[model samples]
Target: MTDAQDLDIPTEPLPASVLTGFLGSGKTTLLRHLLSHPEMDETAVVINEFGEIGLDHHLVAEATEDMVLMNAGCLCCTIRGDLVETLRSLYRRRITREIPPFRRLVIETTGLADPAPILQTLMSDPLLVERFRLDGVITTVDAANGEVTLDAQIESVKQAAMADRLLLTKCDLVDQDRIDALTQRLAQLNPAAPILQVENGKTEPSSLFGCGLYDPASKSLDVQRWLKAEAYEHDEGHGHEHHHDVNRHDERVRSFCVTYDVPLDWDRLNAWVDMLITLYGQQILRIKGILCIAGEEKPLVIHAVQHVFHPPVELPSWPDDDHRSRIVFIVRDLPESLFQETIRSFNEE
Candidate 1:
């Protein structure tokens, strides 16, 4: 048996993305389209089978015993072990040349799976962290039934709230009015994530990936695109007048941005974030900000999903002339006043 200390781990970290959506939201369809692209040649896809009869495997072409190699050179496999084991096994196979080497991984979660657990695994597991990086989350929203699903299903709401890119699938089937309404609702739920339309699971690969602080292709941090604070700022100015009813399914979900004119105290800001996440991590779906810390010349980028946060990264310089700090929050059942009061207290001290 190979010794534990001798295990071969790849040095270069690969980007891994999570694809999630409600049932009948065209997640598998989207995956099929993505696998057909030439750019996806080196991607390893892991799909979760919810029930005994997993139809997604069959729907995807080029089936073997456990894995499928597409014509475009992508490797697709159903989840054999738990996610961690599955990932580790893939790494071993790559090391041994048992399978085609993959540069990236795409995980397709089951319809009802809460992405938080998977994210926690990716962030907290030391081995996985060293081998793979979280690129971002892409959530497919069914334009036809999305509004009703969001109305009745909390899972759907959480999926949308935590997504980095909101893909509205089946848009061709819906009328303009329905599309407009759903778009508005999704924006209300997550103002920071850009909404993209996908008809029959067709979308450019570039649009879905590269959402993290580090760009996979460029090997540099794209702080401006990663923060996207301007989206939330625009929403804050133009969209706040419309009030959602308490009876609405996503009434508790809120998206807003907070800006500070003066450079913030790093210790105070860190303490506030720690306390907030400690108390309300579950309710906080996502947080991203560009902060002008008092002592730092370059701005600091803060990112968090639920309770887990990536290490804060400092940019080389501010992206624009705006030197103010802007933080975007996508949270549930939390009032803006709570964050405002906390920041105010920190600034006062």
Candidate 2:
């Protein structure tokens, strides 16, 4: 293990990301490549089990203790009891000079696991909030079978819709036509997330990391990059409200971005959001926004997964000249027109 004293301990909470995918989606392969990358050298990984990830052979010839330091300087460990406990233990070990001073963390969930609970745990657990902030969710999709999987498995649809970055793996095994179809479907399921094609887990760490509002590499908040609201510009004029296919799992989902030119009253906005969550929390898969509050000069950022919202953060200044509020929503069976109409009704009231 790299000596803790030699590394720079993070002054702020470490950014943690969740890596999830359906069975045979190549999460382990992608993680293996990430662990070996030079850019991920200072990263620590928590997996459900060592046997599940099958990373033993790839690890360096180091002692197989609770945490193993890879040749590229990455630290790998299996979950201890539960996720919250494992993360707390990792932070404790890091501060006490027991393990390498890893700057970031990645948690790998089981193939069959629901990502919402994991995200909820990260957002709601006070201890985790104090030590680590959620970076984003990275999901892998198998190019050959993604369509079939999405049709049959609701969990796979959730994994895709909730991803901040979607990786299309095993592309070489399929034709471009299949890849194109899957890409279009994923875009429909989640417009804001960028879909990247991964060839046998060989991808740049930059593409997968820094997905959250904070850019660890630049040590600054990257609201524009995190939001990617432009992705929804293409979504406009597309009648997502009219499309309905209850048979297909992804057909029930809709993703869109809304912008408000007027500054919003904080209290009214809060009330509206509370009402929205209270009534449709389960259908609302993810919500992210950069708001222009009525009395605030700086932009306010809000993030939510299901019903759990992160504490609002105000930037020192707006990211750009545009002062309009932009909000992105990835929801299931929620009519886009109805959602926009609700906002209109609230604004009028």
Candidate 3:
């Protein structure tokens, strides 16, 4: 009974972390300082307002309204029916445990939300893509008008080109010649996240959760940095990027793939990758994939950002076996026809 009891490994605990930014960029003052620390005991917030999930989080006495508003807080504005009914009511209260078995799930989008169609409605939700696993996207940049709010906002430069950690908040109202030219314009706009600064909204939950999801061998949350954001690099050119006419923030955020040989149904292939990044997530900036649904043996990865998505990830095997479901997107003037109409509308659903 020792090779780790032969081989089971899934104790049950890894799912939360979404939090985005743009409007005043502080994200509820860093969720009131991470619900007063102690590693956010039993954390489970949802707060997405503009239509529903918002109530000042009951004056944040450590949050809970099961909030998930969607009348405008841009989670791809009315995308595939309010992101599949807020992920089927947060995965049916997390599988009949009926709430509170939670150890994580802090959603919080809304400042014109677009965390890639709410991380592809939590990675192509068929039912929260095999329990739940995508813990990356933590944006929030401001550092006193974050470099002219990334040049008068393009959804604050697509929330800093779909971040994985950019924090930066106020920084004592800027002045080290404006926080060194806003940290050299965020290292020329995201050179693979890791830019923390914060001052008023405070920082440190281990510099906001270990990226790569969170897995120092099981501290959890590392789906290869929310599905390997092509190991990162977007250089800079976003004037609200276009695509085909070219402008993945001024070029080369390229990552292309669109396989098939069949096996889809996973929520109409995430509603055509959330209506093709809600009509070009500002130019299909960075998308990721690895799906192979149908009967499900292993392989179901999907990540997005022009329409804000990041949730589907299911792999218990076959990092190789050529199962076939790969999706990789990254855009700029739509061409691969919404990635071939998002896997041919999952064969007409």
State each model's CA lDDT, in order.
0.79, 0.79, 0.62
lDDT of 2 by residue, 209-258 (tens): 88887554565666655577777765467644434366898888778888
| TM-score: the better of candidates 1 and 2 | 1
Q: Where does candidate 3 stray beyond 4 Å?
A: 1-140, 147-149, 152-159, 171-197, 200-202, 205-207, 213-216, 219-262, 265-284, 290-292, 302-314, 317-330, 335-337, 340-342, 345-349
Model 2 TM-score relative to the real fold: 0.87
**How many clashes show up per model?**
0, 0, 36
Tens-digit lDDT string for candidate 1 (1-349): 5665655455668888988998899998998899899998888887776665556766765653235322211111234226777787777776666677788888888887777777777776788887888888899999999988998898898889888899999988979999999999898788778899988988889999887766646756665554666666544456455566567668888888888999999989988999999999988877888899998898888888788887777777777889898888888889887997899897775
Off by over 4 Å in 1: 1-11, 63-81, 219-226, 234-241
Q: What is the TM-score of each candidate against the true structure?
A: 0.87, 0.87, 0.31
Highest TM-score among the candidates is held by which one? 1
lDDT of 3 by residue, 1-349 (tens): 2343343323553565688888877888888788788877666676766664555565456445444444444565654466666656665664444555555667777777756666766666665656556667788888888766666556666667667788888888777898877665664455456677878787767667655433434533344333443333233775333333232242333434566767887777767666666766677767666677887876666665555575554555654456666554555446655566656755663
Candidate 2: 10-residue stretch with minimal lDDT = 68-77
